[model samples]
Target: MDDNKNLFKQIQALYRGLFAFVVAFALIGVGLIAYMNNPQLFTSDITASETEYVPIPEDDSDKIEDGVHVRTGFVEADGLMETVNNCTNCHSSELVLQNRMSKENWIATIRWMQETQNLWDLGGNEEIIVAYLVKNYPVIKKGRRGALTDIEWYDL
Candidate 1:
């Protein structure tokens, strides 16, 4: 009879512990539901007068040139955003601005990047990007300075 009573007490303690655990879990669940239903209840409110405000002076250096994007310096034209998004991800916009090339060269460069640099396939955006680059930054005829016209020979 004593052994039986001890076993019953042990079972009662286990049931009580389980009930407490379930109650704790249910309370947490209810708290989460309440929070999910109305989270603004937990957020603090502040009046504008409590915070300090400062004004920033506007600088126009980047925006001086018309049709030039202030941020990337990309010419404002069709396909501008596409080129900026696709090309500027891996490298800076300055790189694109500097390397002026024809459409064929741009295609070749893109292919090279894909083969070596793990650049993703651009699909239709390739044409747009190449067009934007070729339009805005096409190759300039750069070579040795014009033939010397009035150069005098120096004595050895």
Candidate 2:
């Protein structure tokens, strides 16, 4: 009878240890889950602000290359020149210079900007802008053996 009581006590003690281990493991798991779900709440001293960088305009005169006529800019055509001036009034000239688009695409983008983004009507300047973008910013083709072969694909 005494041995039976000792055996029962051992079993009870084992069960209690197992229960405590299980409770500790569950608490650790809950802690991990909470940390993952709310990382900012667990962390100390951090904040963020949304910001955008705008490019500064470059002087057109400085961009004139050698052998180019003084009267004409990179886009010497009167129509294109007029478009560049009109478009760059709101945005930087660099934005206009960096983007390459087909004539149709450029017209559609301009129209969208005007209709939705409060961009003013081009007022006869659309033709000049379209021509300039088409001429200078033609769709680039890949896999050509030219001076650009050494340049990185992303850079082009």
Candidate 3:
């Protein structure tokens, strides 16, 4: 009984000691924070490197909060609400945004997802989603800039 009491007493002493140390460190941290002027911290000009400065080009993409660009769940469009309600269940909105397809292609892609990727039949919502996707993300004409013209080659 006496031995058990002694062990508990020792444990209690150790716990008290640890508590005091933790409290001391916390108090010191608080004191340091209280002693400092917050304005100086923000106003100080500090830079690790000043070799090169290249500004990012502005994009029309919407930012949730100005000054910081955070990717949003959905882009602003006519059928945005319908698209969000139907899509974004299996994949991210970013994925949808990245892909561009025609109306027919979008329909085919949705069918493929339903058949293989375990996507449920979107039913009436499918048309709305397809319209939204086609309107926002149309197939780009990816080819040469101008019409082809036959040019005569002369030996150098």
Model 1, 1-156: lDDT tens digits are 999999999999999999999999999999889889988656664754467777787886446268887788888889988887788888998987888888899999999999999999999998888888888788988798888888889999
What TM-score against the true fold does each predicted structure earn?
0.50, 0.44, 0.45
* Model 3: CA > 4 A from native: 1-73, 146-156
lDDT of 3 by residue, 17-75 (tens): 99999999999888678658453553444662444677888784545354322454555
Q: Candidate order by TM-score, highest to lowest?
A: 1, 3, 2
lDDT of 2: 0.71
TM-score of candidate 1 to 2 decimals:
0.50
State which candidate has the highest TM-score.
Answer: 1
Off by over 4 Å in 2: 1-74, 144-156
Model 2 deviation from the true structure expressed as Cα RMSD, one decimal place: 19.5
The worst-scoring run of ten residues by lDDT in candidate 1 lies at: 40-49
Which prediction has the highest lDDT against the true structure? 1
